[model samples]
Target: MYTKKSTLALILTACLLALLLVAGCAQNNPAGNEAGRPEKQGAVTVTDFIGRQVAVPDNVERIGCLYAFSGHVVAMLGRGGDIVAVVEGLKRDVIMGELCPGIGEALVPASSGAVNVEELLNARPDLVFIRSETAANEGEKAKLEKTGIPYLVVDYRNMKEQMYIVEMIGQAVGEKERALKYNEYYQRCIDRVQERVQNIPLDERVRIYHSINEATRTDARDTLPADWTQVVGAINVSVNEELKFLEDKYFAGLEQILLWDPEVIIVNEAGVADYIMTNTQWSSLSAVKNNKVYQMPIGISRWGHPGSLETPLAILWTAKTLYPDLFSDIDLVAETKYFYREIFNYPISDQLVAQVLSGKGMRAPKGKAN
Candidate 1:
């Protein structure tokens, strides 16, 4: 039975069988990730605004959240207890009181060293998260790295960028699944907004004048450039003309704004109402004469949080304010309640819900808090 040809065929058959067995094991174990597959089993990697690749953690332990809304996103990931800090817990005492209740007793430092960076160092956080693009500058990046910490930044300058940031945040915090859920919800809001604002014919869409007052009346940059202007279906009321007012500065004056002469005026929760109602120059604008003025809600009015779940709500509300008839069927209050419940997992009482949505006692500008 020891024929040379027969022995060669036997060895070939054994090799083929071994190869199939190895393939079976690989399929079952998924030992290596292929391209387009999320690494570490559903853990996706994202490139942050500053251009760095980072893995989105599934179990964020100790976290340093730079903004209140980013903390809310972490809560969505089922890890609020992990967030050890926030940026001043929102300057408006009333909203913070309702939101965190007794929690503000916990110190919120403006900088990493405010209470002492030692606490953060000792905590050995699995990750640290911050909102707003400014946090990701070279200085801060170097600081984080030197301290053996990982940091990512969110840029909410535009609606699309804002949504991307939220998804990125979700993934980074080990809430990829939850992040996906939020994305679906955010897209739904966009769809609803489109349906509502579509009634305004392209050419007929009203022009808007958007501003933020921070102890002084001013023009908000991204309000006109990105979210309200450049969003896919949004129409711009003003163009970015070369002006001294539009730089990195967050606030500007009525004179410059009047020159823009938007058909509609969107006031951020700064000292805008007082200035517009008082300043004769502002009153002269067509928006004031025609009652086409609307107030942008508090929280990220000065600067939106690109990735947090709340950003889309702000957009949807703005779109509704702009086009009520088209969005008549959508109930913002109910939707907001659902949003808070699902994202924060804290059942916000009807009274609190009313307060969050109401414009009563809104904080006048004392400098840009967002």
Candidate 2:
């Protein structure tokens, strides 16, 4: 019993048994790790548009949209019901209100570049989304960072960025597949327009004047409207490098607009087309004289705006409007219905479709004084 070789063999057997027992315990463990200890689990890191790597919960439920654009994106991702806090405009948007009911009850804890930390915390959002402008503000960034909650900054100045933002949001919110589907559709739309208008000479392209909410407020060189108008095979009269005298970099004087003498004028807001057509001040413009003034359609959001997810529809609509013969086979109404049905998962009625296409009764009603 005291023999040295026998004792050494007995020790080796005990060590082998111990190793086997540990492995069996590990196999039974759900983590299936060698240590037999539960693995730490919680968050998944996602990179924002601004390059901030934020650790978002793997399963996000309560979302805080500090920017209206992200709110719309979240809604489009089919997570609209999960939004707990929103920027002011989301509650006020008519289409958003209709599409995402109970959005009105969401808390408005931020405005512009300002965040009320206490209120935002009170909402208990699992994640937050803000525009890059807000993140650029040092004070706002500091406040958001101090909250100890994950936040993602979203920004897009061009069409490419716009598509990327959708993907980023989709990933953050567990809707990557849905986001890929939307981006695919967006690319197809772009390709369709390019294929249709490839042969049209630059000189033959229509000269268009696009007025934003106000009649004088127009897009500039680096804006989305400027980018999309060119893509649609039209000249944006307001994007000239020579016109460096833009007031606030957006407003153009009546004299400047008249100088452009645009062939077609499209206003983004409701009732502006009528004003441009009737006003004596604008009566001498070529578009006004030719009865070519029109209003941009208002869908879930105003299609002409930079923040809109429906920019593809805007591009298609504008291209068709300018070159009807080229896009004559495209049924915009059918496309509109499809967009709502597939993307929003909401079926829009013929009446609502008529209202959106006509650009009437789309604006949110103003609130009364408290």
Best by lDDT: 2
TM-score to native of every candidate shown: 0.71, 0.86
Per-residue error (Å), model 1, residue 142: 3.1
Model 1 poorest ten-residue lDDT run: 299-308
Clashes of 1: 9
Top TM-score model: 2
Q: What's the lDDT of the predicted structure labeled candidate 2?
A: 0.83
- Residue 58 in candidate 1 has what lDDT? 51
lDDT of 2 by residue, 108-136 (tens): 89876688987887677778999877888
Q: lDDT at 277 for candidate 2?
A: 88
Q: Give per-residue lDDT, candidate 1, residue 322.
A: 67
Candidate 2 is scored at a TM of: 0.86
Error of 2 at 84 (Å): 0.8
The list of candidate 2 runs beyond 4 A from truth reads 1-42, 242-249, 368-370
